[model samples]
Target: MKLGDVAKLLGGRLEGDKNFEIEGVSSVENPKPKTLVFCSSKRDVERVKDIKQVALVVHTPVQDANCVVVEDVKYAMAMFLRIFYPEEHPSGVSEKAYIGEEVIIGEGVYIAPFTYIGNKVVIGNHVKIYPFSYIGDQCLIGDETVIFSGVHIYPRCVIGKRVRIHSGAVIGADGFGYYIGKEGITKLHHIGSVVIEDDVEIGANTTIDRALIDRTIIGRGTKIDNLVMIGHNCKIGENNIFVSQVGLAGSVKTGKNVVLAGQVGVADHVSIGDNVQVVAKSGVANDLEANGTYGANLPSIEWSRWKRIYLYLLKLPELFKKGS
Candidate 1:
């Protein structure tokens, strides 16, 4: 597409050679000749003119270069390229797919080969189950949900519409619950279900545990990052963002719009309020109030002071070697 055509396609204003043809989209730092490069923010405006690409996408016009200015440069660039190089939407089920008995597969469902749909499972319309996916017994998958390759949904899991279950995600895993009995140490029973609400995107290899007698619920639009572990009976809130490797203990409750950054750990039975933002690697041992930010595992301090303090502490063992 030409630079002028790309700008029209992306709903952006072009301030360059309208006849310049753009083959693809790329980054400004490493621009491909025919490809259109994009700027990150206003700070990238300085380098926009020096970019080697034919077309550049930025928020405002840059001097001495062919550029397309848009409200959201990155989003506009993405939309522009996706239109030209569009990914194939998931379509029909293949003949080689292993569909189980009593499986109610809905219309427009894409069932890849070797996928195991268990008994009494109701798959919704436009759902895509990639190869090697395992949907366990009696599961209900909502419409437009995509279960990626190697995903394992255990029995009775209720997945909602437009939910994206990434590769290797294990839903409805057994809870880490145990109890002491008269005979010996016995394992507690897990008899609950996992209900994932609409527009939630579960990351790869993440495990969400089932409850003891109720439900482990994930609210709408909650985006969980890769390698996170959500323990049993946790009630996650709507539009929450849980970053990579976050660990939420059992019975934890979060209100709407909560944000947990990378590697944050929440203790069991803690109730976090709405709009809370936990920083990266935070160890949240207590409850967080609404709209509050707390729990930093890594303390921010002056590097020079920390180095001096560490150096003094390191000489303690040597100073007291053979004496007091």
Candidate 2:
């Protein structure tokens, strides 16, 4: 692609060398010759300052270099990446894939070998199921969805359009529910299902448990990071972002645009309001107010200092008593 063409596609302003050929897009740290590199900051610009062969998609024009200046550098970079390295939409179901009785597969669907589609599964158009994926009975997979290798979708789950579920993601898994009586501990059966709405991207190895009686809903445009565990009956709102290792206990509800950073844990039955942003490693035990940033976990320190702080905390009562 030409430099001017890239700028036109990305809706950016072309600064220099309209005819310069851009072979690909790369990072500023290790740029390839004749490729387009994104420079969001001055440091990034400085790193590739002397490299005149590569074109720059930057926030501002660099002197003596081919440049495509954009309002949002990251957005421009994403656009360039999509054009340079477009995702493959593989068509045709493999003969080795096991299609169970009465499966309704749409046109342009790609089911790789070793994939198991259970009875009465309705797969929408252009859907791609990679190798070793198990789509349970009566499941509904929408159009343009991509289920990567080793994904296990339990029976009756509904995956919406344009959803990307990465490898090892277990959808509609049984939630942790139990009852303790005089006799013994009894397991509670999860009869509900999981509904992942359109444009949601579930990261690799993330687990979304089924509800107890209804649907555990993952709203539209939500992005869940890898290694996250969402418990039963979680009604996650639209455009919510859950970072890696986030664990939400059963019945937790999050409003729209909520962001739970890495390793943030929410207790059972807690309700997080809209536009709330919880910092990394925070433990949310109660309901959070709307449009606020919250954090509870303390920052890390040296082990010796932590020990001293622990000792001081232990002696707090005595110190209070003496002061009184």
- Largest TM-score belongs to which candidate? 2
| Model 2 per-residue lDDT tens digits across residues 189-211 | 99999999999999999999999
Could you give me the TM-score of model 1 versus the true structure? 0.87
Whole-model lDDT values for every prediction? 0.89, 0.95
Q: Name the Cα RMSD for model 1.
A: 4.8
For model 2, the local distance difference test gives 0.95
Q: What ranges in model 1 sit over 4 Å off?
A: 42-49, 299-324
lDDT tens digits, residue span 136-238, model 1: 9999999999999999999999999999999999999889999878888888889899999999999999999999899999999999999999999999999
Candidate 1, residue 146: how far the Cα is off, in Å: 1.2
Report the Cα lDDT for residue 9, model 1.
81
